[model samples]
Target: MASNTPAPEAPFDAFGGGAGPAAPDTEWNPTEGSLRAENRSGGRHRVVKQRSNFARSSTVLGVGVIAAVGAGGLATAQEKPPVAISLPDLPDMPDLGLPDAHDLPGVGALLPQENHETVAEGRANPNPLTVATYATDDERATKAERAEPVADVQAGAGDAGEALRARILQQAEQQQASADAADKAAAEKAAAEKAAAEAAAKADAAEKAAAEAKAKAAAEAKAKAEAEAKAKAEAAAEAERLAKLGASYSMPLSSYSLSATYMQSGSMWSSGYHTGLDFAAPTGTPLKAVHGATVKSAGWSGSYGYRIVLELSDGTEVWYCHLSSMTVSAGQTVGTGETIGRVGATGNVTGAHLHLEVHTAGGDGIDPAQWLRSKGLSL
Candidate 1:
């Protein structure tokens, strides 16, 4: 083996370790323009400046990794995912009733519903941002929705709204019908009551009128019956009285001609008129009594020559005037047709006649002819 290797020199000490003081050339100053400047002190030529484009291998790898991570963080910040919310299952809640159509302002039969199909479709993609695109206002999504043959979501909502509106209309109609029925019933009831009251009033009036008429008829009938009975009794009593007179009484003078009537106007007597009926007969004609009576007086009067007063049981006085003689004495009873006096013209007479006068008790004289007619005599 050839042995020609040079021995290595000992290392120099820079921090003053057994070496002499450092030379002025050992210090480095970068402020100078260049280390290879020309020797200005006329010393050995300035060491040539050494510069190397060098790098550490480990430091290069760390810088490359940091740059790549920063680029990835920038991209992640630009793109965001849909906000995902994990909600706990809601507890079974008590039923809180929804508001009625009338309870809300302008609700008008609208009902809310959940869109489960849209929610499920979003979850199937496993990408919240991809699913968010479906709900975006982008031109792509808007165009896709417009291209559909029939709008599914809008058609479903319209159908539900129409059904709710129809139901509301039906309910309104039912309520109106019920109200009308109630009104009609009330009106009919009022009319019936009015009719009943009118009928009752009419019935009362009719009853009162009928009762008045019946009472009037009864009173009239009673009065008529009483008058008829009174008339019949009077006629019967008169007939009985006349029948008694037919058996026991008669005309005062038979076969005599009637002369002056009672109450005849004349100036031949003192009283200026005739006061008794005159019967012209023979001077001795028999004069009979009209009825049974007692003789009250038989005497001579100035104008009557001889007179006899016969008083009947009822106090009626019968006077036989101008008599020539009287058969019955005073205070003597005589029957009907019996001779009570004789016809004669004894005083104040132009001819032989009999004058008869009838007088009621305490009253003036009456016509003998009328008195006889009352006793069932036609004359």
Candidate 2:
């Protein structure tokens, strides 16, 4: 059997087919490499190593998923209508560090060329490079075109929301100020009402006090007037009592000077002391009876010349001596205050005067002044 190991200097076939060696530092093209056949022996196939575009494509797809999630969340948050995105067509990009496809073996069909003969003949193969590009320059152009109008719509929504928030804050401030003003007005009204009520209460109290004082003063005045009326009535009653007593009694002489009293000690009398009351007057002065009486004797007697004796109804005797003359008989009756005789110096002579004496019913002499006073007479 032949050894299956190839020599170390042999060229590596990346496509698993016998082909020419690749140039140094050049990347293989997929459109040319994938069309070659694989070498197989028995049931085993040869393992071929080639560069793939999967790493770049997977990175682009992951970025696209993240970008899509962010865009969906922004749209839901804004809650705005979607706007169509349009962009101006960009100029063709300059090539990167790649050889011309025309120089590469069997890669001419992968690039867009000016020739359309194969396409018109319906024999052109599908180019893998132009298939759905995940991280190609053409994809970046499409994303930019869609994002322009979205940014404009988001900005407009933000401005409108800011204006609405400002208006709400202004309205709240105005309402608060109005409420404060109303509260202040209500408090002021309540205070004014309280002050007025206090003033009214004070006025009522003062009026009540004044009324009480007036009533007290009136009561006092009435009591004083009643006392004065009672005093005047008592004085009038006393005067009436004195008037009744005056009609029954009187003094013997209306005008006279007293010379001697009853029982006065002197050497000029028969008993060595005066036993009668003496009244001095001018000669012929009238003498009157002291009370209602009847004459017991009216005659001249020695040492008692020209005297008269009178007897009262109660059997009391009164004698008038030293008279100038007599004017009544022994049996004549006389009333009180009636003129009976005259005054003169007679019998036991002295100056012209009247000497009066009194005796009780037992014929015993008493003080005449005291006896007259007992009968309600002022001597």
The C-alpha TM-scores of every prediction are: 0.50, 0.37
For candidate 2, the per-residue lDDT at 295 reads: 97
Off by over 4 Å in 2: 1-245
The C-alpha RMSD in Å for every predicted model, in order, reads: 26.1, 21.1
TM-score of decoy 1: 0.50
Clashing pairs in 2: none
Give the per-residue lDDT of model 1 (tens digit) for 1-379.
1111211221122122322223444533233444235345443333322221111112222332432232233333223322211111111111123222112221111111122222222322222211001222222235555433123323433555566678789999999999999999999999999999999999999999999999989998998898889889988987888877666668887788888998788878889889998989999999998999999999998888889999999999999988888788999999888888788898788899988899998868998998987777654
TM-score of 2: 0.37
**What value of lDDT does candidate 2 attain over all alpha carbons?**
0.62
